[model samples]
Target: QGVVDPLGGINTLWPLFGIGNQMLASMALILGTVVLFKMKKQRYAWVTILPTVWLFITSMTAGWQKIFHEKPSIGFLAQANKFRKGLDEGVIIAPAKSVADMQTIVFSNQINAALCAFFMLVAVTMLISAFFVIRRALRSDLPTTHESVVTLRNKEVRHV
Candidate 1:
């Protein structure tokens, strides 16, 4: 018999997980450049390409949080100060800063949340598209279609 599947779950999830996240990003860069060179249907390519840029920016901000131990932005000082106050009543005085800094931290958090939501939407869409493509491929039978009497395309032939 044929070889048993070595990666059952991965084979199923690869397109949705792999392509929708990492592979799509790489493809976006390559395909975007190719589309620009070909001068073809660029609108579709831009839709895929723009998200990679957003992902890059978001990853930069989020990655810093994961990689380093740093104080919150000045905008978040109020919340940070609030926590510090609770920790030691006599210590950890809040830094003097403009209200704008607090607003900036709050705004950054909001921006971060919004970016995550948008990327999730993109991933879902990519998953659906992948499913449809796989479904079509599974349903298609070129071997049988060639034997059929009906023509798939009806364009008139032009002989040079």
Candidate 2:
């Protein structure tokens, strides 16, 4: 689900590839927004951050649900667990539920792990970049500094 399908259609291309890259996509958007804030104005930053916030919230919520999801047919981990349980019980499980299926499960898990790591690294880079931007902004605003004045507060930036 795209969260708001009316705005745009949901993308199924990733599911076919066994990758859910929504979080990565959203984090990229957020990283771009952060960059825009630094290159543009702090006031504009506040406004631009709204969509990023929504994206972040939805991405995180969806990721959490997918990892701990209850549905066997939906979540990958759940599906794998169910298949394993079925195999252990010697019951017919998931279509072929055999060594091949186990291999696939392990492969899918590794892919998921790589995706998570990639996303985490990106998020950390964005956070660090944003931190530096914020620190620079704060440094320039010290009372002793004689730099061209720029207000940090949104209310004040509105007037600027």
Per-model TM against the reference: 0.35, 0.60
> How good is model 2 by TM-score?
0.60
True lDDT of residue 77, candidate 2: 64
Q: Which residue pairs collide in model 2, if any?
A: none
Model 1 residue 2 CA deviation in Å: 54
C-alpha positional error of residue 108 in candidate 2 after TM-score superposition, expressed in Å:
2.4
lDDT of 1 by residue, 86-132 (tens): 44453322332434433333343344334444555564465456446
The per-residue C-alpha lDDT of model 2 at residue 124 equals 54
Model 2, residue 65: displacement in angstroms?
1.4
- Write model 2 residue lDDT over 1-160, tens digit each, in one string: 2232211122212442233365566666666655555444456666557776776666656655445567854554666577567656766544444655554553454344345545645655776676686556545533222225456864444322
Residue 127 of candidate 1: its Cα lDDT? 48
Residue 2, model 1: lDDT of 9
- Candidate 1: residue 100 lDDT (0-100): 40
